[model samples]
Target chain A: MDINTVNSLSYEDFVQVFGNVVEKCPLISAAVWSRRPFTGLSDIEANIAEFIDSLPRSGQEGILRCHPDLAGKDLQSGTLTRESNEEQSQAGMTALDSVEISRMRHLNSEYKKRFGFPFVICARMNDKEAILRQLSERLTNERETELERAIDEVKKICRLRLYNLVLSDTQNKL
Target chain B: MDINTVNSLSYEDFVQVFGNVVEKCPLISAAVWSRRPFTGLSDIEANIAEFIDSLPRSGQEGILRCHPDLAGKDLQSGTLTRESNEEQSQAGMTALDSVEISRMRHLNSEYKKRFGFPFVICARMNDKEAILRQLSERLTNERETELERAIDEVKKICRLRLYNLVLSDTQNKL
Candidate 1:
């Protein structure tokens, strides 16, 4: 995980890391998992660049697939990984906040009905209000447009996540 | 612009590139730009990671700012060196069709009225229909939420652009 080690990872090894994460997170997986191996880090990087480039065309369905349904209060709270849960809490949607919990439920229901999937945003950086606002605004969009926007959003999330994965590996090695 | 050259770039060098872009396109100047020198590539990578981590709570507005007004197609287009123009065009959206061009102009007006800035998406990968779809759908969100989403989107665009900048430098050197 050292910077050198990360930089040195074979394309297969790098793809495996991405595959493992994608296998668990289909949204991200869909965005990147399907791509073929690159010749080198630069090639991998270019693939990423092209993938990011393609996001806007895929639309809302693409975006929503990347997120989990909002946390339900009665639902098992511990289902998410520790890292994901911690990230959720950092964004202030703690499991115990009844108001937020209920709102998330309602929003999730409306969003699913409208878009046919969970309301997805890169939740790592969003707060409840922002999420709500996006949900409300996006609902009004025609399905096709929303789908494209959502996909674009999802790609951004993936890119950020990919950067974090590499950075974390580097930090751990240090 | 080798990897070493990119890695060796002083913070001042990054600022110069960023400032040039910002001077040419003022909308993005409000957002902070930083490149930590000597963190190695990993440290530089971490700087980007932390910057993304610190983005605004909402996703909509943040996403919006990273984009220039669609009508201001000339901003990025005009500023790019000939090689960069070819690169941007290859990603699509350079010569928007007539209907799409008008829609961009129309959306440009409506978006500014709705949110005080032109509708911004990382338009590099999106065609006219996809862009229009997002514009219409995102218009429904409450202002506050839209703002955050926009900011989040912008950060993603910035990171992608940065990666391209770095990778391109590396490729050029090779």
Candidate 2:
């Protein structure tokens, strides 16, 4: 979307457009959308600033909601857009050797059994080996601590997404 | 504990010590812990590496367990260990600004009413304002997505806690 068009979009329309990007990642979309009224926000920085300023208290939780479970490969690819999925695969898991993949699967099961949820991590910028190493290490964390750590990772993911959104918007303008 | 002490500790002991830190911030702790047996690793790089590695998974449902809806400000303060209190505080309502605090209370009520759990986030490393911003933005997400996000956030928190433990150990060694 063009800067002018994005800036001029009605709140609902804006939601519809950007919301699609965020649909699979609803928390991210809501985070971006909740902070709205992008008028005079031609540049990405201004848009982010406005978006941040416009965020509602209730929406933070929504932003936090969209993260996927760590080592869970079953989620619909739509949950992450093509771009994000590609980035994630490239950065975090594409190079996983069979041994690491098996370890990840075993850890994933154990983690889920203990915590009742899949392990979750923000996989945007990390490489495969680093993620595999993490999977092995975090297995020892008690349920109480591991759960909270996952959420913090989600926050980082949101921030990274926001940055990516702005960067993409800038690229689109160019 | 010192590196020698940490080295001497069994995996269970390591989990006990590092697990406490993971409870505070899982992503950070997990990231750090994954790189353990730190004989050759430098301190700062080890910490940074852990932080990088502790990100949440790409796409999966997350855990969601909130602290008690409302407790006396000091109820857990002296009773629990300092670190435990801090971990609770990361989820507790005290640190939020008035608006966010109230909204959290309100939404917490609604969420509890709906899902039988208090609104939870892995709040290590975030300030009241940023947290508030996220809270407001996330309210718009669907219930399922929000639940997933909450769990993801929790995992990230655990990883951070893991990272901290490693750093603390390295410091003790030095």
Candidate 3:
């Protein structure tokens, strides 16, 4: 759908259209859908960032938990929400060799076990090695700091996803 | 949702409720939802079986492609739609140790390279070792035979998933 089509869609229709663009946190799209005719991607990104940041810490955590652990269980079955499947695969993380896969599995489990949710990252921004390094390094973080960091990563992910969506819509229009 | 409630859901709602219940083929739920007010699980299964079998060869192939490779990348990211994640993990494929992981990776690539889609099986009914054994063994089948075998496996998966969904709904009522 193009920008005008997106802006004109009913809330429910818009949600169905843009909802999973940012993975499981569809509410972000719902919240921002009314601010239609976004001049471009920046308008959409700013509002989404603000909306997510404005959520209660617990709400933020809930959205964070909605994302899967990096290189975790979703790939084995091709069940990642459409956006996540594309982003992870694009970064080459989905097809990790055994050693990298093992390392990822351990770090993901330990991170979740310690922090109470899966690790989150902007798959579009980082390759497997960077993701692995950060996953290992972040394990030592205190809960509060890590939570903030994860939310920040989610913002980056949402930004990239929105950019891609709008860009795709624009291209399709042409 | 129970069978009765399932009978009442609009086709889209039913699809949302049970679409990926068969992994990636939401259309299966859409196809079967109208034949509802099922007398029992078997009735539902028979209809789903008929719908899938009635499809053209390409339609069958499309649904088959929706499923991920066993022990494939979907596992690493915790991205399997909820039903598939549970099934694969239940059979111990999601938590494979290093050696099994590597073996699965190789087998999955080989199978897909030969057959053109993921190698799928009903993980809930078999242990990971059995899955691995079958994966290795199935690699040598002629393409036509392997496609038939994969569809048979998908039927088994759909049956178990439907049973689990109905059973869970039944239990929830009690």
> Which structure among the candidates has the greatest TM-score?
3
Cα error, residue A44 of model 2, in Å, equals 11
Residues A1-174, candidate 1: write the lDDT tens digits: 444564454332444465323212322222332343334334444554464443333222322332456564312556665445655666666644677667677877776677654566666778767876787788788877776676555555555555666566544543
TM-score of each model, in listed order: 0.39, 0.38, 0.50
True-contact fraction per candidate equals: 0.00, 0.00, 0.00
Candidate 3 residue runs with Cα over 4 Å from true position: A1-174, B170-174
DockQ of 2: 0.02
DockQ, per model, reads 0.01, 0.02, 0.02
Model 2 local distance difference test score: 0.47
Across residues B67-153, which tens digit of lDDT does each residue of candidate 2 receive? 323322333255544554665576554555566556656765555455433455665656555655666666667776776666556
Tens digit of lDDT per residue, candidate 1, span B59-136? Answer: 222223323455455544585433335434654557677787777678767776776544656555565567778888
Q: Give the CAPRI class of candidate 2.
A: incorrect
lDDT of 1 at A166: 59
RMSD of each: 22.4, 16.5, 17.9
On lDDT, the stronger of 2 and 3 is: 3
| lDDT by residue (tens digit), candidate 3, B31-132 | 465466776677878877776676545445545666666667677777777878888889998679999999999988888677656788889889988999
* After superposition, candidate 1 runs with Cα above 4 Å error: A1-12, A20-63, A73-75, A81-83, A169-174, B1-174
